[model samples]
Target: FSEVSWIPNKHYSGIYGLMKLTLTKALPSDLSKVIVLDTDITFATDIAELWGIFRKFTDKQVIGLVENQSDWYLGNLWKNHKPWPALGRGFNTGVILLYLERLRRIGWEQMWRLTAERELMSMLSTSLADQDIFNAFIKQNPVLVHQLPCFWNVQLSDHTRSEQCYTEVSDLKVIHWNSPKKLRVKNKHVEFFRNLYLTFLEYDGNLLRRELFGCPSQASPDSVQLQTALEELDEDDQCYDFRRERLTVHRVHLYFLQYEYTPTEDDTDITLVAQLSMDRLQMLEAICKHWEGPISLALYMSDAEAQQFLRYAQASEVLKNRKNVGYHIVYKEGQFYPVNLVRNVALKNANTPYVFLTDVDFLPMYGLYDYLRKSVVQLDMAHAKKALVVPAFETLRYRLSFPKSKAELLSMLDMGSLYTFRYHVWPKGHAPTNYAKWRTATTPYKVEWEPDFEPYVVVRRDCPEYDQRFVGFGWNKVSHIMELDAQEYDLMVLPNAFMIHMPHAPSFDISKFRSSSSYRNCLNTLKDEFHQDLSRKYGSAALKYLTAQRNM
Candidate 1:
């Protein structure tokens, strides 16, 4: 983008704006033409009609644009107003049709550069960077531009003075809010256009769909009324059944926040990769404060929750200002947590070479970020098949102040204020961390893998992704750990680094797993199938290892 020579001013100086000049080279060779548009515009007609206008372009015309409707370029509205020179009226880059093939043939790159260089000597700077350079180029070569009608781009800026374009509100084909004030623009017919925008905002998208067609196996009988629908189906075919709902789901918005963090060669920091729903959003401030490193979060939410989250994040003092956090939303059509799916989303988005895959509920010990970085280098785990485990603990007391160092945590452990995570209820989960050994060791110590061991670890980003087949509760995390063992990655405990899980209300899946026998049966079936699949993938040795661990 910096390759384009353009003068920058306060209002319009983003390097991204200069990217428009390089479209011919940026895009593929086969793409002959493209219509670029600004984000702050509303289409009043089908965009296909706008694409049709390209058919009328002459052989010499390489760019199609609508002329500027405002006096910003006219240099008459304000005192000492000086805009970059435009022939009669400057064109808007907001709505552009670039003839890439034609632009390439004319050596468009050199032409734009030369045009900008010639203009900058007379006009020191430009308020509209790309738009100014474009107008200056067209001034020199008038035959290369195809002028679009004013109706095509109905500008609604402050004192646009476009009365010559249209008489009624119905004349607008595309409404470009080309002003800082946006909807509050000083125009005659602002209300009608504002109402049209509001109408689309309040519109219900689901009302447009006639019927669901993707789930081919599921029957959609019109004969079954809404009332007593569940009673009519078999016990195994309930809508709330995990298997049934899971199959009907279609994943959407997989990478909602794309390229939030680009990997750099020198980036050796550990990124905290986690998943959470809207309920745990407040936990972010604490987690980020303690870690002070990059975080990639996968947010599982509905469409409505997504909108609410954006508003919440904006209002949040800590979240809105932070540049280290990347929030990616993954929308699925079911009530299940889809835990592994969410974990994979976070894992894949982490730009750093090392990632500490943990739950959102856990808060790291202070300076764990720097400790992990130092440990990775000291242990030489950057290129080795090793997983550096961070010992996890939990407390029964709800209002305990977080310990800042290893000494304070050990003191609390001696006082029985904190215990190993899920120590009594589910010992197998973090027991493999060997808290007894972790307390005495001052350096990274090797811990043998055990079945169902899922301690939070800082591993390389290329570690096998969580097996997405397991959803809800039960075998989700265990399946991932089992695969790591089969692949022969050693799990070593980091003595200084630790994470403490904050107490929270039990999730719906956990409650179901305890009370509902049917849910347990379904989970057991899934677990057995997962074991068989793992055995087939890693051979009989993997099954023998699991059996040996279970016997112990």
Candidate 2:
């Protein structure tokens, strides 16, 4: 009887038979040579012919194996060994003729020790675990291996066909159904192999039919109930299920804030400021349509980009309906985006007591304005010094129309897709860090101010404005946040409010800008200027604050 205990290989669970190969050391001393074959194969020729191949091996050779026909090993297995020519003849361990005496004499146990090492396994990229380690060892000692003919292992996989095999069907010595077990449903080659295997098993037509389609008696009551439940799931029930599973409720500090007073009608004074580019016209239009109330929009853009935007805005129906939108053109001759300067210009133009600083691509969700108004009234009544900070969300594009309610928006979005400013919040004494934990639900609840995130910030007009010296991408809005934090101002994040950021490419090309010496010089100059100004105002304390704020 050809019997062996099917113990799972520690590294390769799928190829469980590999565990038996490691125990070759326990075999009888007289048994010097043994033919190792995978279970998913059938012999076409006599077993004596395979044993005769041991005569062909050289003195240095300990094993004889056929090369893998698939290109998977060529890319994944041989990635690090790109320049080596030996990689072309990558060996397969499925059908190997092992010389037990030579292996024992050469101390083959060291290879098994390396396989047992967890650190070594973690470093390797190959999915076929044991085979990958074997190939790596063989490559290092190339003279210890002999390549057999492909006919000895006629692989039946997606890439391997009968026509591609080295030998004719009548002359073939072995049929290795390597992938037929998994690929029999979709692949014709695997299907053909499956039929041949069934025929060899002496399965009749009725038995074959029963094997292909499961027998009726095997069906369970649980499966029938599950089918009935699936049949009853309507579109509304599906939408409810999707929302329950996929929607992430971002809980912030404001959700627990006590609201004792109602906002007066006169307290709704907020000017929205955004630095715009030509490509963000759709975003501007969306903001104008969704944001309720007669709030002012102060938009800043480059001279050329502003002219292009004016033409677009005149034609857009969304922009035409809005009566309170204002555009300011800041003249700059070069392609460099003067983001901080543009924002400062917008800040200067704002007439209201409170300003909502945000990008053109962001818009407040429904009922946020009412919530903000109430919060502002409560804050004013309590005499609390704070800036309103709202978390930002990216929209999922499944729905055609803008979301009218939070419930509808939650249904459309995947909870896993929720992302916000990561480096904004910091621990009690630590410097600002972009820790991954800060962005998730595990974020610690503290009443302290969050620094360096300003995508959507509602601040008092009297607060420290944006530093005008900073240019392009890096540390543009961050300087303002740092200054506020250093001054002991509270940056309160509103839990109930979230602004949806419309999908668009970043305004500045970071890769192109980072390479430019002028961009680097501009950033360094701004940093020096900030250091000088803060040093003059706060003395040695400024350096300590700046160091922590800059993550130094």
Candidate 3:
């Protein structure tokens, strides 16, 4: 085949052999018939059935094939040849039964010489390469071609075409998916073909599940047992309390440390701070297992809820034996959760030189601690004012079981899905609202625009704390972000580092709170009073510092 000389077309260069039908000329003179099949086809019947078609061809016919089911050829050739059916809309080359002796006797090489002419070659190059040339040759000599039954090459491009030909799956002899959109589960012939394809391989449930849903092939016994238990649990029971049984039944822990960085004796100073409320025992356990450093957890709830958590913690041997974990209770009266106040209390208890402020639900990915440790060591702690920010993603709402590893958790995040900003500028304010633009970056960059503080922030011990006055959900942390900007500090967003936020039901109704009078009053105070106070404290220093940072 390689000895045959052929003209190369840029569009069809990859399949040059198919474009020129090079194999036909390379065959010996004794060979009379040849059947060519495309790779994107499936054979339902015996190969002998396809070979039987060549016997029906007439003495003058050189090729026997089915017409293309689509109007794609007509559209491509319409510029040169007008009207719909003038040149007889082409045939599909996918299933071709050719009489090699008849083609050689007809002087097929003359067609290649005509295609090489400068004027004709330019025209053929612009059109669909091989198919167009074959159609033109057949049009010039109509007696040299014969049309086969549509059933011989069943086109599954359009589902409607199936009704015109084969009505049942067993009737199909050859299935050709020759359309731009290939065979998907949504396609009409998918069910018919999928069942037949699966039958050829002796269907295995475990292999199919792993291929479809990314289930681990070599999952440990503990993972399999936990998955089965979770499926058997009642849907109404939101809180499952069987930590001791899980520990005894499964030899391995729920989560494992994949990697840990060893720090110098003098550089071992960092604390993770989080604020928790009722019905968050599962999240607390995950955080304890995931982090390798010390943690300062502030539990903000009623006296009864605090006691409930304590009982659960004592029952679980893993949490009870951890000496590095410390708990602080901030007993509150009302149903409203004070976001900033509890966070402030947790930050205050952090005794390390650097502290990471985050929520209990956020689970840091593996290697996050090592990345942060390296970042902090390179920074000038005394003179450089900076805060490290990490990207956060929420899991799908319907997913019940937590992933056992960081790679598993990341595979769950839908591609091209970005987290929506929790807080937007309310009632006509001049602030940028599109937070997704930050994700276009691939490396750490400074946040000079209106940045939100909803993500986890790692800062020095002397950095300004959250304001305690702003109560529940709305604009609590955002106000602190504004203050940090006004104090001339750099907010660097790390695009590579990530933390997955576990799915859960909302603690309170967001729409009801947004419409209440108290919420409107809080918005007013934040814009008018807070802005004025910051301006009075540092009038021009903020702008000057911002200019210097941009220059750097």
Candidate 4:
């Protein structure tokens, strides 16, 4: 309604965007919040109620969880197509959510003009369609997103898109018939899709266990049979079960602990354990020799930090045959890249099904991967978070980086070092597992990997994607890295364990060190002032520290 432009099949040339293209800009205005539901959608339930849901989140910025509801027959045409990285089974533009203020602040309108429009007609012929246009926004402002449930936009009658309606037909919130033709309930397609929901969410290898292989249902039951079994199980914190098949051959990774100080002879608990840094080589060698899980070393380093790492690796018996050890360094190169880049890189290179990212210095307190393995067993494959961050990845040294001598190093450790903003996650109710609430099958679960490391997380790689722009070596510019993060990958953070930046003891005050590091001294007086403004603007943003590094 702002302004109008005309095209052939589509008309949005002026203020608005092409109908085929959807939104003309990346974000909404600073003045108000807006929700744009696509014209193709048919709402079978009350999504109008969602506005109330939006009101509850006054401080947090967000976009609506889009349910890709493009028509079924038409969907088959594009099912193979990879559209917005916000990725669902497909792109259905029936419903969309937007935030105007952030959009204007980030120059989204200009970005849209630059990225979305190609000549006048090219806008009419873009590939991302409307959602791709929106994805550009979604990736950068993920925190501003709200992941709506799939039932909100039911694509009815795909392989099983409409499966949940059979059992919970009355519970349907939004039925989005986004198909190309005017879609309606024809055959009992909705009912079949509804019933099949239970099968998809809980599907495991139970059938394969029983069938031609002749394995017993007790030995391994089909998912449907397992569903009957789970009815007997209760949800208890301490209670968990494993697929019997997993009992056959199990591989475990051990996290070693800190070795800096020697505790008093009589004070057994307080004494610093002897150096495992020395044994790491031998221990890892043995683990790699037999166990297959990946073992990662998490250490904070700068261009200046000593390569005791290289020495440790050199000492490793496995390194004598480097192929077996599988050593890799994970970190971003740019000064503005966040500390999480290192973790992201390590996870990326990890090959085994079970990847262990542990501190080279300190190990977990209790000798345990058993309780965690049991926790893993209890996960609803469809509902489980793939990456598991444990209090396991830790060190003995506390805050050593903050030492006064490490001042310059501390400077480098400050915020806004990361080039891109984190991505939005798939809203919970929208996940395939929600079918279980209605006694339906769950869809296979996956987490999009757009790394945002504030509160800790450990995840299994489902769609283990990284913004390739940030990967390898690449020079970055404003919004470009964020643009890539926005276009590809979804990020989720789960509360759990964290990576301990092991210090020999709580000797250094890294934050003070950061304030006083070499980078600070080298910076011009202007940067010093700008640094203050930046800290205020981004609020402990990693980029400020990185920017100071860049300035240095």
Candidate 5:
């Protein structure tokens, strides 16, 4: 104990937040090069599994808890801070994976001051002080920062590790959970604050009930007066108000856009019908280069990233309005393995009448919006509950894990589009030049009437909202598809209306997606309902697509 001489710090309003700043200034130059955090981060997953990753991620430099400040917190990306992984933003201050050399050169002291500025930001010190400060440094100086796998700072959030849900745990390198804050706030003992509340209850619980019972429970006027004094206590209590806590739950309005990106003006809010995300941004930009409406981005993100991005997205503008685009953050927090929540989150957050969803990565070489517009004119598109329509295309990269035969590859590059089904869904919003009518217009859509029919495919943010009771990982979505058969919605597949899925690979390959807990949970959750529903909706529909195509 004498060799390490650590002091109990209590100099500022938020001493915990200032730990990073103090460490930056105090570590001896000759001390051990690496400074690992000994946080009592509650264990949620296998620490041993994460320990194995530290060795593999050795090439990576500097890691810590990822923070949500850069996205939505005012104090997080405060006027003085910068963006993440670039110019620096708020970072978790609890534990850091530091190359002390980098810290010294960047004037890490200055970075910490900007984040935890006890002397400068006494009022703002109560929030995101540690995490945001650490990240701010990394964003400001990217060359020094690297993301670690989940093992390091595992308990940063309150959710249990078993409850955690992320797209890939392999991507998580380190975990960080700063000291618990519920018991303490801004260097004040809040546990005692609650104790005071209890004390008030002890003094006046019976009397408080009497006030409503008409002055009968209180033994005397002093008792009634005591109740009044308690009521007024909140005004003077230093415990502070819970409702005023800057952030409680990260609120993100969800949406689904198919191919919704455009390289339009920064103010452009071109809205496309499908759910979209970064994977399809480039393709969307190409498909709807001229869209003048709002563009929806289908966002499927890591739970932590969801918090970070959602916060950032709220303040961001895509054509001016604050809520230009909604985020369908697909997963919940704390579970090392949960996938159903991913689909569930997307299912519930959709705000628009329609949602566009695709696994497209990068921009398309041709405009898909043009083909959709033509199809919409031909098919007579309906709204949310009426029909589900999509365009079909044959490209070298379209199908996941589908290998193109040499002859097919040589002749299939023709860019023209066509439709295998006659319904209208996503019409050309980006690059449309024409409109086409369905051949069987005025005909009644009857697939929904079939007892065996089911939803053709799962669309992110599609209606009737998922029945959450069916969740595990992937089970609920599959059930909804089965339920869709009984609901009477129409479905179709078109050729001319298609856009490239991008980074196309076989959908069945488990290895490509990363073997994380979320992925496993979803796969294991593929129960009877999921399979049957998918079989009715997509199995037959898919068979129809292949059978019909093979004959041609």
Candidate 6:
């Protein structure tokens, strides 16, 4: 396929341009026929009508295509336009009805190859890949194509003469934006078409009806306890009201669309669950590069940010190629960061048995992916209720080469360049990891749960969901770890595994927590309610270790 030369243009010069030709071999043997539509085409009418058109095909017809709407093939669109060979008006490959079984029945592969080779000798280079060869082939053997009506694919290019097919927008079945300028393309009915496109973009899909088929998975008794506590709170309790409002609102998952990475059976055991806002998107490359396994990433953003993130991710050198990362966008709501809410989304969307919950800013120790896999098996975490903690450290410097090994990390720790996360500001944050013992220990060590202890860990997918009641800064992760303890899951530290925090400016919520007394006071109230709810559900044993819970 590479032997044939293509016109030097970014839009239509890749080998993927010819992928449509190889679909007969690419798809399964049992798949008989399929409709292939370009990403630029938007259906104005029901697609069922187009599928029914297949019944109109003759036994000799193996492909269905609409005639190209412009005079490019006739070399009349521009002063010196040189398009490849075609029969009269060439057929467009944008919207195709492929009869795979019939194509394989005939020697379609060998025939197209010969046609392409023969045409290339004269044309020297084809502007469009398979579209050129396809038209050239049909010019010789016209029986293979069943010409579709032009209305089925209303070509909307700058030079498109498709006005002959439709006098009104209602007559068009599909609108194909064949030009790079798309909405900016010069058309007689530009406003109508542009408005139509924008209307679809801003359409409210909630108008569609949906049905729940079965009972939802029941929440834990502790969840009900928390709800009861919130319900019984005074009307003036702002924190409880905030929690209730967030809990009642449904979270939007896969905001635009979802592309779940398919991992090998052996590699699907563990998924890294992390949450980030738009500002942290650039960190995805380093995270993906170090962690080769599957990742469940939750992005917190507004509607505009979601669109911006989609564009950035598409153009990113590292993010564009990663099939192992699953991006779930949680639309930003209200003032709070919704930190735990974002965490819950990532956790719930994860498909693997175990998930390593961490922040997107942290880079895992080089071998942590493989190390955790071995630890999960050796520790029998799949069957046992165990959470393997990956000790976290942070550097004050904004930029530094991350330590690749535990020995290097220990060396940096000794040098005072790296310290346990929040060591000076808040020692209790990760103090439970007992880093003093971790320095010499070579095996997993049991960690007794303490108040406000929130270390990143790899736990089972079925582990308790993050407390939605804890919305913002203070107790977001603290409440989650407290629940895990209440549920009686063992927190064990992996001796070798570590995560280094790439420091950044404080989050909006954290800044709010520090400056606003009301914010801290609200967090304290929410923390009290959360602990009380846990105690009521788990019978006071859960909160026994704390005579007093510290306020952040």
Model 5, runs deviating above 4 Å: 1-293, 298-324, 328-351, 360-385, 394-462, 467-478, 504-509, 512-526, 529-552
Candidate 3 local lDDT, 139-187, one digit each (tens): 6677888887777677766422336665655577777766545556245
Give the C-alpha miss distance for residue 539 in model 5, angstroms. Answer: 22
Q: Would you estimate the TM-scores of all the predictions? A: 0.81, 0.44, 0.45, 0.26, 0.33, 0.66
Residue 484's lDDT within candidate 2 is 70
The order by descending TM-score is: 1, 6, 3, 2, 5, 4
RMSD to true structure for each model, in Å: 6.3, 26.5, 23.7, 30.3, 22.7, 8.5
- Tens digits of per-residue lDDT, candidate 5, 421-466, equal 2123222221111113322222323232222222233232345655
Residue runs of model 3 more than 4 Å from their true location after superposition: 1-264, 334-336, 398-443, 451-453, 509-512, 541-552
TM-score of 6: 0.66
* Per-residue C-alpha lDDT of model 6 across residues 344-449, encoded as one tens digit per residue: 8889988788899998999998878889999988998867899899999998998878887888889999999999998989998899999999999899999898
Model 6 ranges off by over 4 Å = 1-155, 162-235, 248-260, 263-268, 545-552
Query: What is the TM-score of candidate 4?
Result: 0.26
lDDT of 4 at 183: 35
Tens digit of lDDT per residue, candidate 4, span 389-408? 33212223343332221223
Q: Rate the local accuracy (lDDT) of all candidates.
A: 0.80, 0.59, 0.61, 0.37, 0.39, 0.81
By how many angstroms RMSD does model 5 differ from the true structure? 22.7
The clash count for each model shown is: 0, 0, 0, 70, 93, 0
Q: Give the residue spans of candidate 2 off by over 4 A.
A: 1-265, 294-307, 381-383, 395-414, 421-455, 521-525, 549-551
Error of 5 at 76 (Å): 31
Best by TM-score: 1
Candidate 2 residue pairs in backbone clash: none
Candidate 1: pairs in clash: none
Candidate 2's TM-score reads: 0.44
CA error at residue 519 for candidate 1, angstroms: 3.1
